[model samples]
Target: MTDDDPDRDIRCQDALQAAYRELVSAAIMAGWSEREVVLAIGELADKHLLSLETNDNADALIALLRRMT
Candidate 1:
């Protein structure tokens, strides 16, 4: 990963909650239900090793998850 990559420093910042919120918002806007959005977010977060205490590599993860549906 390059230093300029936005997700590069997410692991160093406590941005997981914000990232999760954004993911949920996007999913809802994309017509997914609350349960579907939550499941998708959780799966994506776990797949990417994201946690509340971790900097979130959420940008790419969110993008990838969105394509699943």
Candidate 2:
């Protein structure tokens, strides 16, 4: 962890960054334009944010997203 990270969450940040990078890389590899990738990610973020204040399990979100396809 860097000294600037007072909360010592560098590892978590690293993992999240890796996930984002992989998602973008995969999207581009699969022929999704940059705009399409951003739109898809925005859709996912919207769905995720919608459940943030609900009494819902994260696994249920996974199932819901899977069903979306």
Candidate 3:
């Protein structure tokens, strides 16, 4: 898979953290309460995972699923 593909499982801990930070910033700017912001971020992550093709990164997806449990 190309390095840019999210399902390629490229090391993305830093990128994910940065993205979460940006989400928090956007939530605050939109006047969302902290709880609402957290829930929104969770939904965003779920949606992102839902968009990926299953065969593109089984290992990475399994690890992520493990963490969710």
Q: Compare the candidates by TM-score and give the number of the best one.
A: 2
Model 3 alpha-carbon miss at residue 68, Å: 37
| lDDT leader | 2
> Per-residue lDDT of 3-48 in model 2, one digit per residue for the tens?
6877668667777998888898899999999889989998998888
Candidate no. 3 TM-score: 0.45
1 versus 2: better TM-score goes to: 2
Ranking by lDDT: 2, 3, 1
How do the residues 25-44 of candidate 3 rate in per-residue lDDT, one tens digit apiece? 88889899888999977888
Segments of candidate 3 deviating more than 4 angstroms: 1-11, 53-69
User: Candidate 2: which stretches are off by over 4 Å?
Assistant: 1-14, 56-69
Q: Could you tell me which residue pairs clash in candidate 2?
A: none
lDDT of 1 by residue, 1-69 (tens): 578888767765565667767878988999999899888767886867756435456666887899997
List the global CA lDDT of all models. Answer: 0.76, 0.84, 0.79
Clashes of 1: 2
The predictions' CA RMSDs to the true structure, in order, are: 14.0, 10.4, 10.9
Per-residue error for 41 in candidate 3, Å, reads: 1.6
Which scores higher on TM-score, 1 or 3? 3
Ranking by TM-score: 2, 3, 1
